[model samples]
Target: MPRTRPLPSNDYARRVAGQFISISETRLNTSPPRRLHLNVNILHSGFVPSAWRLPDADPRAFIDVAHYVRVAQIAEAAKFDAVFLADNASIADQIDFRPITALEPTVLLAAIAAATTHIGVIGTASTSYNEPYNIARRFATLDHVSGGRAGWNAVTTADLGSARNFGRDTVPVHAERYARAAEFTSLVKALWDSWEDDALVGDKAAGRFIDTSKVHPVAHRGEWFSVAGALNLPRSTQGHPVLIQAGGSADGRELAARHAEAVFSAAQSFDESAAYARDLKSRAAAYGRGPEAIRVLPGLTTIIGATEAEALRRRDELVDLIPWSYSLNRLAGTLGVAADTLKLDERLPDDLPLPGGGNGNHTFFHATLAQARTHGYTARQLIRALAGGGGHRVVVGTPEQIADDIEQWFKGGAADGFNLMPDALPDGLQDFVDGVVPILRQRGIFRSEYEGRTLRDHFGLQRPVSPHASADSGLTVNA
Candidate 1:
């Protein structure tokens, strides 16, 4: 049995208890109310590279199971929809200065799921390097272990470091990666749907264990892979773990439109984000999915304080802690230029082209460029604005001010919700849960308590029925 951690202190519990409003009381409008979906991205110590240097931070939190459990507990207490984890198969970061994502996401998430209930656990798994059958089985197990609160953030790896680790001399071309991703995702879904919902029958009296007639083989053969399917497990509680995709290129958008239930977007401004949301939904509609088929959750970093000045001070302190050399190199990687190409006092190079000849991470490249070009920021200024990160929008202010910004983005159709990456972990997440959550609750846009158990329920998504659940499909489970 997984050991359970205690909830917040009694004082905090009472305070949150007082804020709870029943669903009946909040339903005033004739139209359906749009509640906010917030997921905390537990990025090691936190989003900032210097976060591990904080006095209260555990330098090894990136690999500490207890650290993630604590963060998930806080998010669940605050009624956040989920806790998200990003993964890398290689040493993708400046590891000398910060902790890299060292643990596999599903493994870490399983530990987190054991320690908490209610909060969804979403993890990234790259289609670039994984077999479809393995990816499907891994997340299915997570969903079952988490009681249907698992989400897979499907992505394609683009970094050369990841390629070399996979025994490849070069990164796959942009189109090929996305194409493989699309097929990879489809095959995974098919495997998940292999067993009909009622296929299992534990009737010892009748000496029957399963209805073999109901199990179907996917028998998928595509350009990138060939798979004989019918996963060994039954469909999970949510039918399939919530499918998520995070990419900004044209190919990425098409994949999301066809398959993704939620997107972790990296748009820097309201206009850009809203436009992206609109375009993505339009594409989804073209694929015969409804407007609500996908949720656009933009990445947001928050630095909170009692006052705006205090918040700015906090932001400055964290940003200043980052070594300029590290920041410059990281920025250069995103912009596809040499570190020396960027001058602290000068704007980005006027003739910047897409990274890796248009094959690098297009999401961050465009988002970071938009922020710099929009404000005409020098390299130094841009780093400060980004809170020493790459592309996500950072907001530094009091809880109210931060709430106001979130409100604008949520109500303006710029986002469905936010994938939060705080400046530091446990402490930073605690700050938001204690300070920002109450305000969001009072405003009637956020949940005071969870209404359902599954991740699909939290996102207000329907449990999907297996398309292969036919009485006489003339298919059998693969050996």
Candidate 2:
């Protein structure tokens, strides 16, 4: 016989203090305690492309497992929800002077998960080149190994460089890529649900390890992919790992609305971020999901110092290290414009065209433009403001000021939380953890200790019930 633990009874007599507060009572006087979710981006060296130039920066950090493990440990200690790793199939930047995304994400995240016990491990995988079954199995395996602390950042590779690496000279049109992505995502979910929760019987007396009748075939035949059946693995602890999306285009938004539990956004200002949050929630509503079902986390890059002047000096050191030619070319690439068209001292072109013929990364392009136009920053100033030559918002300040900025954004409905991209790693993250996290905790917007075991628990998301189980039981499953 299989030994099982007894279930808890609803007995107020045994309730612990501060553990059974009623939602209505708490909501009457003030909003329920709002938690600010944070995820660290473990990019090479750090967000600053020129960070490797620093004497203490490890150039080999791009491929070093120790480097990633240390970062994950720090983030876990700070109670961050997850550690995100972005990837590209092809070298998308000028690698002669800097590092590119070296290791594959799923593999690296497995390593990170092995070292850390709590932090969610998120890895990017493009639907353009990979099959839905493979992604389903890979993430499910990670979830099993990590004890349900896995998340998948679904993305469509947009750069022509990536397409060429896969034997295609030209990238797919924007609509086609997203259309395929939508189907691919749906199929993966179906595969995950192919097995009912109780499919694993493990009945030693009956000589049965699994209830085969409980497992069903996905039977998905789509335009992009035709997957035949159920995933080899059983249902993961979290049911399915959290689904995260990061794109700023219309199609991207629609995809996220229908499927994503969290959306990683690049909005350069409070108003922009607020509008984006509203738009995403509204879109989710259209798909029958409540606003609370999805979290909007805008990317934030912080350059911290003891004083404002010291912070600016640190920012300058990084920007100055990046050559004008490299910065200009990099910025142009994000804007989908020619490098020669931009002048370092001049403002961005008034009528800058969208890159990839409307299929490019609209999120970054729009966010970058918003920041540049709002501040009237010159090309050089814009480059410095961007810090890492990416479109994510960058702030330079003391601990207090940085904490204030984070609070303002969270309270103002601009963001549910932030996806932190520190200017440099280990040290940059350590500064934020030591200096800024205390302020956030004092203000009562961040967690001091992890409250749950899985990534879904950290994000306040429910563990999904298998659709097959719901069907078998004649119950409906909600997103």
The candidate that achieves the highest lDDT relative to the unseen native structure: 1
Candidate 1 TM-score, true structure as reference: 0.92
The per-model lDDT (C-alpha) reads: 0.87, 0.86
User: Where is model 1 more than 4 Å wrong at Cα?
Assistant: 1-31, 471-479
Model 1, 107-206: lDDT tens digits are 9999999888789999999999999999999999898888889999999999999999999999999999998999999999899888766566555566
Error of 2 at 279 (Å): 0.7
After TM-score superposition, the amount by which residue 362's alpha carbon in candidate 2 deviates from its true location, in angstroms, is 0.8
* Pairs with steric clashes in candidate 2: none
Candidate 2's C-alpha runs over 4 A off are: 1-32, 470-476
Models 1 onward score TM values of: 0.92, 0.93
Cand. 2 Cα-lDDT: 0.86
Could you tell me the lDDT of residue 208 within candidate 2? 65
Which of the numbered candidates is closest to the native, going by highest TM-score?
Answer: 2
